[model samples]
Target chain A: MKVMTLNFLTCAVKNCKSSNDSFPLHPKEAELAKDDIEINPQLLINVLPRIDWAALRTTSTELGFPTLPEQPPSPEDLQSDEALLKELHELLMETQMMEGKLVCGHCGHEYAVKNGVANFLLPSHLV
Target chain B: MLPTPDTSHVPYNRVYEPAEDSFLLLDTLSSPSETAFLSSRFCSTSPSSPSPPNFGAPLVLEVGPGSGVVIAFLTAHASTIFGTPHVLTTAIDVSPFACAATNLTVRKAVSEAEAEAEAENPSTSGQWTSAIQGDLVSPLRPGSVDVLVFNPPYVPTPGLPAPPPAPLQELRDKTTFEEDSHLLELTYAGGKDGMETTDRLIDALPGVLSERGVAYILLCAQNKPEDVKGRIRSMGTGTGEGEGWKAETVGTSGKQAGWEKLQIVRVWR
Candidate 1:
C-alpha cells in the first residue's frame, strides 16, 4: 500500500466510522520499499486539496519519515519548491508499505499487511 | 478505441474472469458521452491552465475488481477517458487473490501504456493507490470516494456464500479445488434476486461517495435495472441537501428481443 492510501482508509468496524482516531490507521512494523518513480509536480499539486494533511502528517511520522509541517504546504508553495515537492512525492508516491500491520486507534484492531496487500476483513466477532 | 488492459496473468480459478459484463463497462466508460461527463466532472475546466485552485484529483475506486480488467483500463487510459492523468485509482475485494491479481493487472496496464507513450509524445497515466482486501466499501473513509465502479455478483442464486474467513485468507499455499470453487462463487452468486449484495452497495453509496461522486454499476436483466434506478433516484446524496440522487442507463449489451440483457447505470447527485 502506498503511504497516500492511508489517508483515505479507516477502521472497517462500523462504530469506528464516527471516531476521530480511526481516520489514519497507524502503521506498525512497516516494511517500506521505495520505487524510482519520476515526480509529477502537477499531480502532486492537484492531489493536495483532496489529501487530509493532518492524517498524512500522522502517517508520515508513524512510518518514521521526518515530521511534516503543522500545516500542509499551499499549491503555490509546492509548485515553486522542488525539494518539498520531491519529499512529498517520495512519501506519497514512491514509498510503498510492503509489509506491516495497520492498527486502528479506536478499536485497536490490527489489519495485517503482507506482500503489500492489507487485509481489512475483520474476524467474525469484529464484523 | 482505447486498448483494453491485459488480464492474461490473472488466475481464473479464484478470480472472476473478464466477461461480457466487464467488456460493457470498458465500452461504456470510454464511450463519447460518458467520457464527456467524466471529463467535465473531474478534469480541469481550462485544459491549458496549469493547476486550477481547489481542483483536486478525483479518486476512482473499483469494488470487487476481480481480474482487474475494468479498473486497469480506466487507470491506463485515464487521460483519454477522463481527459486528465491526475486521477487516483484503487480497488477493494473480499478475496485476497482478486486483490493481488488487481495489483498486477493495474501495474501491467500502466507500464505498457507508459512504454507506448515513451515512444511518442509524453503521456501520464493515473496513479494506482493500492488494492485492499475488504467487503464492498466497508474499509473506505466516508465521503472520500469520487468515482466508484462495481461489477458485482448480480447472478441470482439460492443463497450468498459467506466470505472467506481471515485464516483462510492468510493461507499462502495452493488452495484446494473446493476452496477455489468457493472463492469463485463469491464473485457471481448474488442471493435473493441478485440484489442481496448490490443493495448493500447501493445503501453505502450515499455515505461512501463525495458530493461530486458518481458510480457506474452493472446490472443484468434479472436484477430489474429500472426498479434499481428508481430506488437510487429516491435516496438522498447523504448531504441532507440538494436534489435527490440521479440514475440513468448509460450502456447496454446482449439485447434479446427488445430486452436488455445487461446494462450499466450511472448514479450521481
Candidate 2:
C-alpha cells in the first residue's frame, strides 16, 4: 500500500522485488512437490518422456516420493486402473506452479517462487 | 475515478432479499467519457485486424459484469436486432453475490426481450448470458470467444468502507485488491492518481483476444490519451508487431448520458 509508480510493462522484471507484484502467476516444479501431493509411483513412467526424466528421478527420490522404477512401470503394470490419469490431473492440470522453484539445467540457478508465482528470469551472466 | 450512483450496499444486503435487487443504480464515473470512447474505438473497428474465421459461432465474453447492465443492453438489443447466436457471455467477477445478481439480471432481461422478439417472429434464436466467479487474469478458453467487453472498477475513491460482517449488509466501498497499487495511489495516498489498478486491468488484454477476436479495454483519460494507450501499446503487443493492437479516443463522457466526467480511452486487438 505504500508506493512505487513504475509501469509494469516498462519494468516488470525489475519489479520482482514488490510483494504486490508477480510477473506471471504460476508456481514452479520444485516448489510444487513441497505440497502434500499423494505420490503414485507409476506416474513416473508415463510422464518420463515429456519432462526432464533424469531430473524427475533425482528430485522425486530426494523429495522422498518413492524411488522411480529402474525402468518405468510397464503398460501392463499400469493397466490395473486409470490411476495415472487421475494422478496426472491433480499434478499437471489442477496444481498451480506459482510458487515452485525450477533449477535451470543450463545455468544451475534456482529461481524463487512466491505467491503461486515462479520467477524464471536468469541473471545476465547465464546467457 | 467514477462518481457512482448508489451501491446500495449490495455486498452487505446479499443474503435474503438479495444484495443487488430492486434498485435502479447509476454509477458516476469520472472516466466514462474514456470508457465510452474506448468502447467505440474498438467496437467501431477498421478492417486491418484479421476478421473472425466464422463470425457467428464465436461466443462473446464480458468480465466484471456488475449489475449486468451492459450485457443486458447488448443482449436485449442483439436479440431484437441480429437474432444471431454470436454472443455467449461469461461474466467473471470474484463476488458470488455479484455473479448471482448478474445471472438474475440476465435472466429477467433475456426473458422479457426474447418474449418481445417471439411476438414479432417467434423463431428468433437468442443466446443467454452466464455468470461465473473469476478474476481478470484467469484463463479464458484459448479460442472460443471472439469479443471481450469490460467495465472495470473505475471508482476513484474506495466507494464504501468495509461493512461490519453480515450477509445482507449494504455496499458502500468499491475498492478491490488492497494489494493493488492503483487502489492505494488514487485515494488514500493523497490525490487523483489511482489509475494503476485500472491500468493493470487494461494491461492484461492481449493474450485474452481470439486470433481475430477483439478486446475492448475501457479506461479514463483523466491523464493523457496517448499516455494511457502508450501503456497498453508498450505491453509486448506493439501496434506493428506480429498482429497489431490499436487505441483510439472516441465519444465523450458526461452527466447528460448519466455518466461521470471521465475520458474514455479505447484499446483493441
- The C-alpha interface RMSD of every prediction is 0.9, 16.0
Candidate 1, B17-72: lDDT as tens digits: 99989999999999999999999898854868855656489999999999999999
Residue A46 in model 2: lDDT: 29
User: fnat, candidate 2?
Assistant: 0.00
Q: What is the C-alpha RMSD of each candidate to the true structure, in Å?
A: 1.5, 14.1
Fraction of the reference Cα-Cα interface contacts (below 8 Å) that each candidate reproduces = 0.88, 0.00
Model 1 DockQ class? high
Q: Give me the runs in candidate 1 sitting further than 4 Å from their true place.
A: B47-53, B257-260
lDDT of 2 by residue, B1-269 (tens): 21122223333333212212111112211134533532342233225764422222334566656556555544554422223323344455544455555656665666565566676654232244245433453423323345566554444453322212222112223434442233222212211343545565565565456555555545433434467777666666533458466666543454353323444444555
How accurate locally, in lDDT, is each candidate?
0.91, 0.40
Top candidate when judged by TM-score against the true structure: 1
* lDDT for predicted candidate 1 compared with the true structure: 0.91
lDDT of 2: 0.40
- Cα error of candidate 2 at position B61, Å: 2.1
Which residue pairs in model 1 clash with each other?
none
Q: Give the TM-score of candidate 2.
A: 0.46
